[model samples]
Target: MIQVKKETLYAGMLKGLLTTFDLAKIIIPVSIVVTILGKSGALEFLADFAAPLMRVFGLSGKAALALFSGYFINLYAAIGVILTLSLTLKELMIIGVMLMLSHSLFMELAISKKAGCSLFYVLLVRLIPSLLVGILGGWLF
Candidate 1:
């Protein structure tokens, strides 16, 4: 029979709670900031600036906000932006796959480097596949 200690369970719960708090710290502030940017039309300006590049992925200029949020901040912020937009199913799927492939670049890249991976190689590996998949998805759907 397997036994679990009460102290061990409590410690695990504490760790989980702390992790959630850390994530919320990042996510909540980012969500609020992005909301402000959207309301103030700054997000639209950014989207317009990125439109040409975004079109290659079959996504609208507005999707640039989600992609930038996902890349710099995290996936939760990206989802917040995505929720506010009216996107087609195909666009959502393409963005979903691309974000899955390359989100959290700075944090993950640092973690990869700490794990002894070459930073440039890790970056290329993460970004190249994301771009390729985005292009393919754009072409197909």
Candidate 2:
């Protein structure tokens, strides 16, 4: 039997990022559409729906205007914009944990399904604990 190594969290994150880059390619067109929708004032209409959830994360509803962008946007644009924002290292760390917790949304699910694991189980594993940590870390830090 082959054993799995689970030493470094960063290692897993990097592995996820590498696989996700294939699909993160979608960020460009999605960003363009979001920008167009925002400029046309249509995004505001939908922002109303996600704002409450965003508030729980300590962000505004408009912040989720970039939900699909995180997977689509290029690293240069994403990192530069976020780095220039008002976030601290703690927030960034939490974002990292949250992202690594949720990266490659499509691929992770498919792989897990093919491996005979339940998607619900995978989601519970990926979403719940990292969110607990992210929320606690954000509050404590």
- Give the clash count for each candidate: 0, 2
lDDT of 1 by residue, 90-114 (tens): 8899889999999888889999999
Q: Rate the local accuracy (lDDT) of all candidates.
A: 0.86, 0.59
Relative to the true structure, candidate 2 has a C-alpha RMSD (angstroms) of 8.3
Worst 10 residues of 2 by lDDT: 67-76
Error of 1 at 49 (Å): 1.5
TM-score of each: 0.83, 0.58
RMSD in angstroms, candidate 1?
A: 2.3
Off by over 4 Å in 2: 1-25, 68-94
Q: Which stretches of candidate 1 lie above 4 Å from their native place?
A: 1-9, 84-86
> Over all chains combined, what TM-score does candidate 2 have?
0.58
**Highest TM-score against the true fold, candidate:** 1
> Candidate 1's error at 97, in angstroms?
1.1
